[model samples]
Target: MAHVTFGGKPVTLLGNEVKVGDKAPNFTVLDNALNEKTLDDFKGVRIIASVPSLDTGVCDAETRRFNEEAARLDGVSVLTVSVDLPFAQKRWCGAAGLENAITLSDHRDLSFGKAYGVVIEGLRLLARAVFVVDSNNNVTYVEYVKEVTEHPNYEAALEAAKRAK
Candidate 1:
């Protein structure tokens, strides 16, 4: 279990967080179109899994920032994972005009959140995390935000993705 904070309140996350050297576990998540997407589809690119809550302000900003930044970078794909429904995610993206990265929903299985060790047990929400996976499917960077209310170390994660290539 991992301990994280939301708005200064400590929260516990279920399952184990993946280490930098470990091969990321396979996860099934739903795309904005409600299509199933797995890690296999993103085999050869640097991937940044940004877990967020669309209902929150910090998460909203994080997604927007990464969406713009991730679009400009080549050979890197940013996937924002949330528990929000597909319709809500699609609506939010359309309203925000976010195109660089993809927003995925884990409401159906809740497996992605658990597998990623971002699921908050009692709260039924995911802890904010930024995981960077290299082309070889090795986890290169991991930041389980100590304070969910705060933003992630975007520069560090981005650098790790770039350096991994």
Candidate 2:
């Protein structure tokens, strides 16, 4: 597992760490409507972003940026996963005016977080990371942000999504 920090303090991440060229793992998460959704539910090129919480500054900015990029990236689907409840996620999206990025809640179980190796042990939140999976479900790019409070490499993830499409 890769070393990560939350608020400058070392934190342990749980689950199998993903890598480039590896097949994307399938995990269940709740949609804004509280509907159960899985990896297979999203098709085509995907930019899966895992954040500690959508309420935080970094996570908010990251998701907003991806939501904006999603409009420009043809055939790419951007999914944001967090531990926030589905209702809260829905309210946040509405208030933020985010239309493109689909926010999924992993609170019911750390299904998405653990499957992607972004679960922050003891925090019940996901570590900041982004994964770009191709149409074939092969991971083409992966970025585990070292600091939980920082934004990810948006350009790299966007570029990867473009390539995937």
Candidate 3:
């Protein structure tokens, strides 16, 4: 379990984030259309798992930023996961005109968040985290924000993902 903060208050994470040398965990999440998707479906491409909660302002900023960045990368795909329902995710994405990254809902099976070590126990939200997986399914970069209210290191993450050669 990893330790993180929500609004500067200490909060404990349930699971462990995929380490730099660890193989990415295989899990299923629902797409905006409510269709099931797995890690294997995105093989041979750089994957940036941006786990966040749509209910928070920081998460909203993170998702929007990633959505814009994801569109510029040719072989990279960003999958944003949240506990919100697919319908809500669709509505937000459409309203924001976010067309690059694919937003997946983990409301049904909290397993994805659990496996990624981003689940907040008491609250029904996910701790903010960024995981970059290489084409071989190995985690190349992992960042679990110490403060939930803070934005992630987008520059470092984007550079790492873009350097996959």
Q: Scored by CA lDDT, what does every candidate get?
A: 0.80, 0.92, 0.79
Candidate 1, residues 1-165: lDDT per residue as tens digits? Answer: 556887788887886788889887778989888899888777555555556577678878888887677667788888888889988888888877774458888888887788888888787788889888888788888889888778899889888877876
TM-score of each: 0.93, 0.97, 0.92
Ranking by lDDT: 2, 1, 3
State each model's C-alpha RMSD to the native.
1.5, 0.8, 1.6
- Least accurate stretch of 10 residues (summed lDDT) in model 3? 43-52
Residue 134, candidate 3: Cα error in Å is: 0.6
lDDT, candidate 3, 27-104, per-residue tens: 788988788988887865555554556656877888888768866887887888888899988888887777445888
What is the alpha-carbon lDDT of model 2 when measured against the actual structure?
A: 0.92
Cα displacement (angstroms), candidate 1, residue 57, comes to: 1.7
The list of candidate 3 runs beyond 4 A from truth reads none
- Tell me how far the alpha carbon of residue 59 in candidate 2 is from the true structure, in angstroms, after superposition: 0.9
Better of 2 and 3 by TM-score: 2
- Model 2 Cα lDDT, one tens digit per residue, 10-119: 99999989999999999999999999999999999999999988898888999998889777878898999999999999999988988446999999999998898999
- Comparing 1 and 3 on TM-score, the stronger one: 1
List the pairs of residues colliding in candidate 2: none
Model 3 shows how many backbone clashes?
Answer: 0
